[model samples]
Target: MSAAARAVVDTAALRHNLLSVREAAPGSRVMAVIKANAYGHGLVEVARALADADAFAVARLDEAVALRDAGLAHRIVLLEGVLRSEELSRAAALRLEPVIHCPEQVSALEQASLDNPLRAWLKIDTGMHRLGFPPGEAVGVARRLMASGALAKPPVCMTHLACADEPEETVTRSQLAAFAGAVADLPGDRSAANSAAILAYPESHMDWVRPGIMLYGVSPFEGRCGADLGLRPVMSLSSPLIAVKDVPAGGRVGYGGTWTADRATRIGIAAIGYGDGYPRCLGSTDTPVLLGGRKAQLVGRVSMDMIAIDLTDAGDAAVGDEVTLWGADLPVEILASRAGTIGYELLCGVTQRVAVSYV
Candidate 1:
């Protein structure tokens, strides 16, 4: 039989999460951030499932193009904007909004055809040093986009929140202040809130609310998890327990003997591992899993194709019993924490070998 390790996409749950996001930011437009292949939930499938979504946000040009080719008529916002001048015409034709963040992008947009001047969002660097014009120069960029005869309409002003997830930080408030000050005179609607802002800071929700992780039912706050927020998990990773063995006390297991049995134990081998997007950094022990509705503990390092779960209580477990590596049974955040990472990395890093099964 084919390997049983799989990442299951929950379509109904995805729709439910989108509704929750809308509920969180009532009346405001919602741009579902489906980047990173919809947080590894399967982009096309999530896109299809959330067809009623107000708009979709992606990072690269190809992702936007793919949506267009898929006959998705909703607005697709390119977060990185146009990387090259050639993208302008295509973006215009596809009706994708490019989030112009730099002078090179502006020059490319100016050089592109005017007939289908693309809709654009101007990103201002409030505090996040990653991208966008400095706060002082944002107003000028907005004006330039409007003045360009090639442009069809005024640009929307936007800024990314540097620390919206951390409510205690003054950064989010500072960012909001900067955004408000810079776009004071700019003529189009503005957006600044990410998932955290949409949830924790209502004042940040302006013309548009961009929710990425929250749409996937993940908690934006660090040290917290989706379950803590009443959000349902949309991805459940599972595999079968294919082997069972009895190990004596003091027996060593897995690579480099990272884990050792302290007493008589039953080890159930689950066909999931780092190669399947499970965290390699998760210690040989202390990692958690669910087997047949019971908690199981990892007793060895995650291998390329399997994880050994301590199943002393699972005397009934057999070859085909389902083992949950994450989701449903254990929150992805919990797994990510034990793995020393975040849900984004764990989701997006699922390797190719594991067959993805959508539920």
Candidate 2:
């Protein structure tokens, strides 16, 4: 209880989610995606929790190196791969599997005289233009990389899904087709499914499945929640109600007087706000919080260090009552929708100002 605001991470729930991923993609090797500081759940903490995963995936070389430095021997793949000579050298030295997306990365690898050869993934731009070579050019790029002798083994073929979360399977099907066509003659294992693809599109689950947000017990689809997907929430953000006061009818609350009481109401000021990564955009009265185990709506603007929730219905609410902003009972996905964002942003946005305790 270092801070009034604390994010309790359930390690058991995290392991359970990983097991769920295994059940969904039993045939494919699980490349647990723990990038972006494990989506703000502490990178090292998440890696240690998912140690049973076949391998781990990060977006940068430093993240991979950090795991190695921590003394864990799990295979790590750098999703974005290396860009410069130094990064290439460091990645190779760390035995990191870099996903070579662009020709510049391949050029760097070919030119660098590393201490050891590196195994890598060749990313093809099936539909997502963010990274990788186009389908027309991927095979040639793979062939050239193999001939360079910088790689320890043949590169694994991989691609990103642009619309795996959408119910319309047209885009995912097309991307899968393009990926298959691009690497049809190539000699290597293939990976394509992300979190959404793992649950929705079974055919996309190839040799490897990189489960990201799903591992954190958050659903990628819009209408569904983590529970709907049989995933248990890992992070439960809670704060204490520092103050409880009575506001008469027409009394305004919070910054800008945004919310006015329609009748005499009880208000509870929670010790959490945008400063602690609770989105300031969550300003609607429909947004609810768990106050003393009862539903309470958020009213007025969210401040940097506090938020006012309408505790009128919870007459028994008192000062120092535990407030659940989002957790097992209160879904972050719903909270995200009220804030005009997604669950990923909410989970990742939790700032360093707040203390995180693993349970």
How does residue 331 of candidate 2 score in lDDT? 92
lDDT (10s digit) by residue, model 2, range 124-233:
99988899999999878988888888898899999999999998989899999999999999997999999999999999999999999999999999968999999999
Pairs of colliding residues, candidate 2: none
Residues 1-359, candidate 1: write the lDDT tens digits. Answer: 55568878888778888888788888689899999888887778889989978899999999988888888899899999876656777788889998989998887766676457677889999999998999899878877777776577788889999888885869888889988999898788889989889889899999899988877778888788876877778888889988888889999888988788999888889888777778777754377788877887887788888888888866678887889888866888887877777888888888777777766
Report the Cα lDDT for residue 50, model 1.
Answer: 90
TM per model? 0.96, 0.98
Residue 341, candidate 2: how far off, in angstroms? 1.5
TM-score between candidate 1 and the true structure: 0.96
